[model samples]
Target chain A: MLSIKNLHANIEGKEILKGINLEVNAGEVHAIMGPNGSGKSSLASVLAGRENYEVTEGEVWLDGKNLLDMKPEERAREGVFLAFQYPVEIPGVSNINFLRTALSEIRIHRNLPPLSAKEFLKMTKEKQELVEFEAKLANRSLNQGFSGGEKKRNEVFQLAMLDPKLSILDETDSGLDIDALRIVSNGINKLRSADNAFVLITHYQRLLEYIVPDFVHVLYNGQIVRSGTKELALELEEKGYDWLKEELQGQESINTK
Target chain B: MMEKDDMMLDELANKEYEFGFVTDIDMDISEVGLNEDTVRFISAKKNEPQWLLDWRMKGFKAFQKQEMPQWQNFKMPDIDFQSISYYAAPKKQAKYASLDEVDPELLRTFEKLGIPMSEQKQLAGVAVDVVFDSVSVSTTYKEHLNEMGIIFCSISEAVKNHPELVQKYLGTVVPHTDNTFASLNTAVFSDGSFVYIPKGVRCPMELSTYFRINAENTGQFERTLIIADEDSYVSYLEGCTAPMRDENQLHAAVVELIALKGAEIKYSTVQNWYPGDKDGKGGIFNFVTKRGACRGDHSKISWTQVETGSAITWKYPSLILQGDHSSGEFYSVAVTNNMQIADTGTKIHHIGANTKSRIISKGISAGRGQNSYRGLVQMGSKAKNARNFTQCDSLLIGDQCGAHTFPYIESKNNTATIEHEATTSKIGEDQVFYLNQRGIDAEQAIALIVNGYAKEVLNQLPMEFAVEAQKLLSLTLEGSVG
Candidate 1:
C-alpha cells in the first residue's frame, strides 16, 4: 500500500533522512525505531509531504499515487493521513466544524456525496466511543487547551472518521499514559484491515506490545540498516542499539580489509 | 492646529475618493451653501413648525461662526462649505406611512448590499427603521411600541405631533453649541429618529435603523434623540452603508440621550460608510458628537459601536454621569480597511459621587488604513469614589496600516480610581499557517481571528448585525493580507 525508495531529505540545509527505503503492504504494521535525530520522525514527516523539508532524492508512493507531488490537502484527500506529533491548536474554531470541513473536502475530491449533519454526528459519536475520547471536546475549539492524552486520542478518532488507506503515526505514544496508549493502540488495531496499512514511528517497544507489528526496521543516521521480525524490537529493548552500532563498525572494517 | 497647517501647506496632498457612486434614484437636493438661509430652506421644505425653524436658524448661526476643532487623530481637507449640498432626499415622498409605500429604488439598493429588510432579515429577529438619505422612509412595529407608551418616530414627525417631548429633550444631553459637528447637525439636520420610552415601560422589541445614502455630493446631517423616562428600559441600534461615491459627502450627525431616574438605555452602531481607495481620495468625512446624560440616581447608559468605514471619521459618543450611583459603559470595535481613516472613542464624565464607567475598544487596521482610538475619563471634584476601567487593543493586518491609541484620564478627587490597558500586534503568518492546516482558508482564518478579538463588542450587537459585521470584516480583509 505504501513504498519509499532511497528517501533523501533535509531541513534548513541540514541532511536528515538519507537513502532510506521501506515497503509496507496491506494488513501489516511496520514500526520504525531509532535514537534521537536518527531520522525516525523525519521519515514520517517526509512521507506525510510536510513542506520545509527539502527532498534531494526520493520516491514515495501511497496507493500507487505519487505522494511527493501532491499538495498536503490533496495528499490527505487521497487517503494519506499523518497524525502529527504536535497537533496545531486552532482557537475559536470548533473541532467538529474542522473535521466536517476536512471530511467534505475529501468527499468532494473523491466524488463521494457529503455527509449530512445527522450522519456526521452519529459517526462522530461512534468514533468517540471507539477511541475513548472525551465526547465534550468535539464541540470545543480544535486542540485548544487539550491535554496530551486527549490530543492523541483525538488523532485516532479522526483516523476512524476518515478511514484513510495509510496513516503514519508520528510519536503517537510520546506523551500518553499507559491506559491512553492502550486505547490508541486498540483503536488502531480495530481499524486495521487487509486493505489498509500503518507506519508506526516510535523509539520504544511498549506500543508494539498492543498493536503487534508485522515487521520491525531500525533507522540509523539516514537509512534503514536493519530489518527483522517483531521479535527484533524485544531484542533491541533488552540489549539496546550499541551492539548494532558495534557490529556495523566491525562489518565496515572487514569490508575495508 | 499645527497638523492642519501642515496638511494645508502640503501641495502634493491629494485625498483619493474610492467609492464615488450614485445609485439611480430620483432625488430632491438643495443647492450647495452653508448659511441661516439654507437652514430655513430645508426647514421650510420639510414643513417644519415655527419653533423648529427658529431652532435650525440658531444652529446655523452657531455652525457658521464655529471654528472646527483640532487636537484630533485624523487630518481633514479644507472643506469648501460652498461646494457641499446641504439637503438631498429620494424623490419618493421622504415620508412613508406604511411599508407598502416604500420606494423600489430604496429596496433594491438594500438588496444590492445584502441587507435583510423584513422579519426574515435575521433569523433571531429584526425590527428596523429604513432611512433614505435624510428621512425615515418606513418604521416597523411602531403600533405595538405605541401601545406600550413608547414613542418611536422620525424626528420631523415628532416635532409635529409630540412637540412637548421634542422641546423637552432635543439637545438636552448635547446642546446646540456642544462642538463643531454637533453645532452643524443641530443647524440644518433634516431628519432622523426620535424615541421616547415612558416611565415604568419596557420596550417590546429591539429598535434599529438602517441608513442608506443614495445621492451624490449631498451631506446627510441627521439628528437622533432618545429619552428613557423614570424606571424605563430601551435598546436602540443604528447602522449605515452607503453605495460607492466619488465626491466626498459630509455627514456631521448629533445624537442626544436623556435618562431619568432608574432608567436604562443601550445604543449600538455599526457604521460602514463608503471608504476611499488606497490613495485616499473620495469618501465620507464623518464628524459626529453623541452624548447621553444620566440625570437621576441609578440611571445607566451603554454605547456599543462597530465602525468600519468613512474616509475620515471623528466622533466620540460620550456619557455624563450626573446622579449618584449612575453608570456609563462604552464597548467599541473599530476596523479601518483600504485607506479608511477612523478617529473615534468615548468620553465618560463623572459628575456625581460613586459613579462608575467602563471602556473597552478593539481596533483593526489593514491595507494602509489608519485607525485610532482616542478617549477620555474625567471625574469632578465632588465625584468621590468614582471608578473607571479602560482597555484598548489594536491588531494590524499588514505593515503599511497603522493603529494608535490615545487615552486621557483625569481625576480631581483622591478617591477616584482608574486603570488602563493597551496592546498592539499584527496577524502573523504563523497564525494563518495553523488555521490553514485545519483546512480553513486565509480569509476565513483572518475573519475568525478578528471576530475573536472583537468578541466582547460583537456580543453586544444583535445576532444579525453581528453576522453582517463579520462579513464586513471578511470583505474588508480581502486582499489585505500580504
Candidate 2:
C-alpha cells in the first residue's frame, strides 16, 4: 500500500534521511524502532508532505500515485494520516467542529456527499466509545488544556474518525501511562482490517508488545540496518543498540582496509 | 513555504468589495463647500423651526472654531471640506402615502441591498426606516408602532410632529460641542431614524434603520436619537453601506440614546460601508460619536457593534452611568483588511453609587491593516462600591498588519474596583498546518479560527444580526493566512 525508494530528505541544509527504502503491503503491521535522531520521525514527516522538509532525492508512492507531488491537504484527502507527536492546541475551535470540516472536505474530494449531522454525531459517539476517550473532552476546544494522555487519546480518536487507508503513529505512546497505552493499543487493534495498514514509529519496545507487529526494522544513522520479527524487539531491549553499533564499525573498518 | 504564504496574503489583499454598485437614479445634490450658508440651506430644506436653526448655527460656529484632533493612532487623511457637497437626496421629495407610491428605482435599490421595503417582502418582526442618501424614503410599520404609543419615524418628521420630544432629548447625550465630528454632524446632518418607547411599554418588534449613500462627491451626515422612558424596554439596530468611488466620501454621524428610571435600551450596529480598492485609493472616512446616558436609577444600556468596512473608522460608543444601581455594557468586534485603518473602543464613566460596567473588544488586522483599541474607564468620587471590567484582545493575520491598545483608567473613589486584561497574538503557522493536515483548506481554516476567537463579542448581537456579522467577519479575512 505504501512504497519509498532511495528517499533522501533534508531540513535547513542538513541531510536527515540519507537513503530510506521500504515497502509494505495492505493489512501488514510495520514497527520502526530507532534511537534519538535516527530519522524515524523524519520519515513520517516526509510521507505526510510537511513543507519544511526538502526532498533532495526520493520517490514515494501511495496506491501508485506520487505522494511527493501533492500538498499536505491533498495527501490527507488521498488517505494518508500522520498522528502528530505534539498535537496543536487551537483555542476556540471545538473538536467536533474541526472534525466535521475535515470529514466534509475529504468526502467532497473523494466524490462523496458529506455525512448528515445526525450521522456524524452517531459516528462520533461510537468512535469516542471505541477509543475510550472522555465524552467531555470530545466537545472542548481542539486540545486546549488537555492532559498529555488525553491528547494521545484524541489523536487515536481522530484516526478512527478519518478512517485513512494508511496511518503513521508517531510516538503515540510516549507520554501515555500504562492504562492509556492499553486503551490506545486496543483502539488501534480494533481498527485493523485487511484493507488497511499501520506503521508504528516508537523508540521503546514496550509499545510493540500491545500492538504486535509482523515486521520489526531497526533504523540507525538514517537507514534500516536490521530487519526481523517481533523477537528482534525483545533482543534489542535486552542487549541495547551498542552491540549493533560496534558491529557496524567493525564492518566499516574491514571495508576500508 | 514562506513564499507560498506570502502569495496567499497577496491574494487576500486583492479581494474586491461586493457592495460597490451605484444606483442610477437622479439625485438632488447640494453644491460643494461647507459654510454658514450650507448649514442654513440644509436646515431650510428640512423646514426646521427657528430654535432648531439656531442650534445648527451654534454647531456650525463651534465646528469652525475647532481643528481635527491629532491624538488618533492612524495618519488622518487630509479632508478638503470645500470639495464635498453637504447633502444629497432622491429627486422626488414628496412623501409617499404608501409603498405603492414610492419610486420603483428607489425600491429596487433597497432590494439590491437585501432590505425589501415592500410590506409583503419586508423582514418579519422588525421595522426598518430606510434612509437613502440624505433623506428618509420610507419607514416600515410606523402606524403599527404608533398604536402602542411608540414613535418610530424619520428624525425630520419628529422635529415637525413631536417637537417637544425631539427638542428635549436632542444633544442631551452627545452635545454639539462634544468633538469636531459631532459638531460637523450636528450642523449639516440631513436625515436618520428617531425612536421613542413610552413609559412601562416593551417594544414588540426590533427597530432597525438602513442608511445608503449613492451620490458621488456628497458627504453623508446622519443623526440618530433613541429614548426609553420610565420602565420601558427596546432594542434598536442600524446598518450602513455606500457605493464605490475613486474619491473618498465622508460620513460623520451622531447617535444619542437615553434610558430613564428602570428602563433598558439595547443598541446594535453592523457598519459595512465601502472599503475602497486593494490600493486603498478611495473609501468612506467614517467619523462617528455615539453615547448613551442612564438618566435615572436602575436603568441599563448596552452597545453591541460589528464594524467590518470603511477605509478609516474612528468611533467610540460610550456610556455615562449617572443613576444609582444602573449598569452599562459594550461589546464590539472590529475587522480591518486591505489597507483599512480602524481606531475604535468604548468609554465608561461611573458617577452614581453601585454602578457597574463591562467592556469587551476584539480587533482583527490583515493585509497591511492597522487596528487600535482606545478606551477609558473613569470612576467619580461619588461612585461608591462601583465595579468595572475590561478585556481587549487583538488578532493579526499576515506579517504586514498591526495591532495596538491604549487604555486610560482613573479612579478617584477608594471603594471602586477595576480589572483590565489585554492580549495580542498572531495567527500561528503551526495552527494553519495542523488544519491543513486535516484536509481543511487555508481560507476556511483562518475563518474558523477567527470566528472562534471573536465568539465572545459576536454572541452579544441579536440572532439575525449575529449571522450577518459572522459572514462579514469571514468575508473580511477570506484568503488571509499567517
DockQ, candidate 2, comes to: 0.70
Off by over 4 Å in 1: A1-28, A38-71, A100-120, A153-165, A190-196, A215-257, B1-22, B65-69, B97-100, B119-125, B425-428, B479-482
lDDT of 2 by residue, A1-257 (tens): 89999999999889999999999889989999988999999999889888889999979999999999998889999988888999989888899999999999899989988899999999999999998988899999999999998999999999899988899999999999999999999999999999889999998899999999989999988888899999999999999888988898899899999
The stretch of ten residues in a row with the least summed lDDT in candidate 1 chain B is B4-13
C-alpha lDDT score of every prediction, in listed order:
0.82, 0.91
Q: What fraction of native interface contacts does model 2 preserve? A: 0.66
Relative to the unseen true structure, what is the C-alpha lDDT of residue B210 in candidate 1, on a scale of 0 to 100? 80
> What TM-score quantifies how close candidate 2 is to the native fold?
0.96
Model 1 C-alpha lDDT per residue in residues B89-191, reported as the tens digit of each score:
7777755665567777667777776656775643444567777888777777777777888899998889989999999888778888777778888888978
lDDT of 2 at A23: 91
Q: Output the TM-score of candidate 1.
A: 0.86
Best by DockQ: 2
Q: By TM-score, who's the top model here?
A: 2
Q: TM-score (chain A) of candidate 2?
A: 0.98
Query: Residue B440 CA error for candidate 1 (Å)?
Result: 2.4
